[model samples]
Target: MSGQRWDMGKDTLSTLAKKTGGNTQDLGGLVKRLAAAAQPLEGKLQGAGHDAFIAFKGRVDSIANDLNAGLAAIAKGQSGMDAATRTGESDMAQAAKKAEGAANFDGAKFTKR
Candidate 1:
């Protein structure tokens, strides 16, 4: 006997996608709150302080925009992967069922002809 065996575990890609998508949602909410909080600070400073704040704020705003876009892309990718995994799992299930019906192994041994 070769003693070869196969063990296929449950699919977890969809679970990972859900978790990653949830993280993006949480981060997106925080980004929104940050932008809102930054609004009232505009025009409240003077001189170099104001210049520095303005410059940094501009850069932060740009970065926030990019971050949101990237997070949105991540969410989209997660959704797509989740869907693909689900479909792939269904196909695997059907195939397994078909294979089981045609299986040649008995409960205790292989019945090779």
Candidate 2:
């Protein structure tokens, strides 16, 4: 009985070792194939990232240019408004001086009451 039990134990251990060895070989082959498959994808991902960065930089530049143009327009409009205000003030001052002179004149001499 002891001999039979020992033989069975030895056979089971041998079978387990054979299966473990085969599985290890298969795992190594799978790892190699996975690495090969991922190589091209890694390069493609890097290229995609670079392209996206360039596109993003272009967009940022365009936005900055547009903002600068808008600011320039706003500055031009502000200068124009300042000029118009100064002209209006000058005209008002002249009108007020004329009214003052007219008030000092005797209206009774120019009209028969």
Find the candidate with the highest TM-score and give its number: 1
lDDT of every model, 2 decimals: 0.70, 0.56
Tens digits of per-residue lDDT for model 2, 1-113 = 77865663324444544455445445545545554565565445657776664454446545545555554555556556556666777899999999998794665577658
lDDT of 1 by residue, 1-113 (tens): 23422322344555555667667656756766775787677678789988876776667656666777787787678668767777898999999999999987667686769
Q: What is residue 23's positional error in candidate 2, in angstroms?
A: 70
Q: How close is candidate 2 to the true structure, as a TM-score?
A: 0.44
**Deviation (Å) of 93 in candidate 2:** 0.4
Q: Show model 2 residue runs off by greater than 4 Å.
A: 1-54, 105-113
Off by over 4 Å in 1: 1-49, 59-61, 105-113
Colliding pairs, model 2: none
